[model samples]
Target: MPCRDLPPPPPPAHLRGWLDEAVVRADRARFLSDLGRRSLGVGRLLLLWAVAAVFVLGWSFIGMAWMAFEQHDPFGYVYGLILAVLGAGVLIPAGFWVARGARRDRQVRHLLHAWGESDRDPVADARVRAPGRSLTWLVTSLVLGAFGLWVAFAAAVSARPGDTTYGEVAYTMGIGQILWITGLLGLAKAAAHYRWAVRTFRAPAP
Candidate 1:
């Protein structure tokens, strides 16, 4: 058999470097876009869960109240009524906000899809940070934490040995702890965002 000549060597290092960088940028952009989409999906699911909880728990309380009324049990009626009222108070606004957020997330996802196709710099744009968004979350966490603390205090004051309010008191304390932990997490997130923004802003221009 006749011997065949070998093919020429590969492209130069500089050209290969450029190709590698291009591929990396493309991958990064896709990753950021996918992350944004997943985050939005999770947010929507959480909102839906909240809505379901509000309705289901609220209706359950109201049903209990109705049964108590039929039995002429004043304490049970009042307890259920109070819980039903609290549930109702949280439900209406949460339902509306979830609806709006779902619609907005859908629109943003559409925009993200379009941008990912056309923009080479999609990673930067896909960050999706509002100027004061972190601050807003921090403030909300503070308010919730404070409210939870107050509730816990009240529960502690009302708690007694072999009392009917023991379960309520324990529940309130648990809620307070959860709220405090949530607030701390929010604070940490806000601080991280602040540090990142500062670093990015102060860095020298490329």
Candidate 2:
């Protein structure tokens, strides 16, 4: 619980006909702190996912480029090169963006805590933040995950017959990895939000 003490100087005056400034400041700080923490967590996970995607997808394109040269397909090789460059190019800016956002969120959390009152009402926050319905997203994630699994299985099984080259295997496996990662991330987020929604909306015990 936050102390009801009025910390320091008075709040700004646009109009003095409003409620207590300290209470308003405390409430806003608590809400922003909560929001910052949640965003920070998601941002970290997203950064990891982004790095993983760059590697998986970038390697797959490299493999395609190699295969294209071996097959003497100029267009395919060029296309692969372009995609590989684009995919890898994004990582530099993406790294900077995530890092900057994470830093800002951390600063917000720290500042809010120092400004007196950081405790948040989870149930009330959930009512505002949680989705109304996430079932559709959940189902979509499941389908994507299943498809990714099938893709990976097919790629792995093809090696047993020695019919497909290593490059082909790498390309397909990379695609599968991308899809699998996306699906798992989506499912996790959607399920968590749905759970929060249920918990927040449930009737109070008698």
Candidate 3:
């Protein structure tokens, strides 16, 4: 007899529904895994940007303090020192907080990847279904918003005629704008997380 290609046996009818359900679950796990990866990347980038901003702006504040002291201006020195201290207090902790978040995200991504690889693993399935929240994002948003408010206040106080240099006014306003924008970005990320959680983990109504 000539060599022939044998037709594959069909799955039993009773098992079809179960197979389909398994496939659906696997697909959902894959989707969540991909979302987690993308979110991780975005979170890391935003956090790194915040850290960079902290160092740059923090140094600028110190430089301003030195200039004020050299110019024999008590008010200027006080203002600069206050801002420098505030920036150090807030931004340093914020940086570390964000860094910790990035590490957690990394671990979550790894777990998600492993879950994707072994779609039938019950442990992986449970891990995938667990809800998570990022405290770092929340804290960072609040911190940045607070800093923005302080900068705005400084700008207003420094705007009095003949009381401040043009550079000082411009710098304060510019930093304020940047801080507000970054803060809004953090809020946006938090909103994204909320939406994802609601969509993915919400219980179905009867």
Go through the candidates in order and give the clash count of each: 0, 0, 0
Model 2 TM? 0.51
Give the Å error, residue 70, model 3. 19
Order of models, best lDDT first: 3, 2, 1
The RMSD of every model to the true structure, in order and in angstroms, is 14.3, 9.2, 13.4
**Better candidate by TM-score, 2 or 3:** 2
Q: Per-residue lDDT of 1-206 in model 2, one digit per residue for the tens?
A: 11232223223455424867567655654554354334334444455456556656566656666666556577877776786676567646655765765575455434434332322345444433435334545666678777887898888887754567777887788788767876786687567655543554455579
- Candidate 3 global lDDT: 0.58
Q: Pairs clashing in candidate 1? A: none
lDDT of each: 0.51, 0.57, 0.58
Q: Write the per-residue lDDT of candidate 1 for residues 1-206, one digit (tens) a residue.
A: 00232122233446656666666555545554453434333343344335545554544454554545445577867876786687577656766865765565444444444433333452364263334555665676577557657766777877887663444555556555545554564456456545544543343568
- Superior by lDDT: candidate 1 or candidate 2: 2
- Candidate 2 vs candidate 3: the lDDT winner is 3
lDDT of 2: 0.57
Q: What's the distance in Å from true for residue 68, model 1?
A: 18
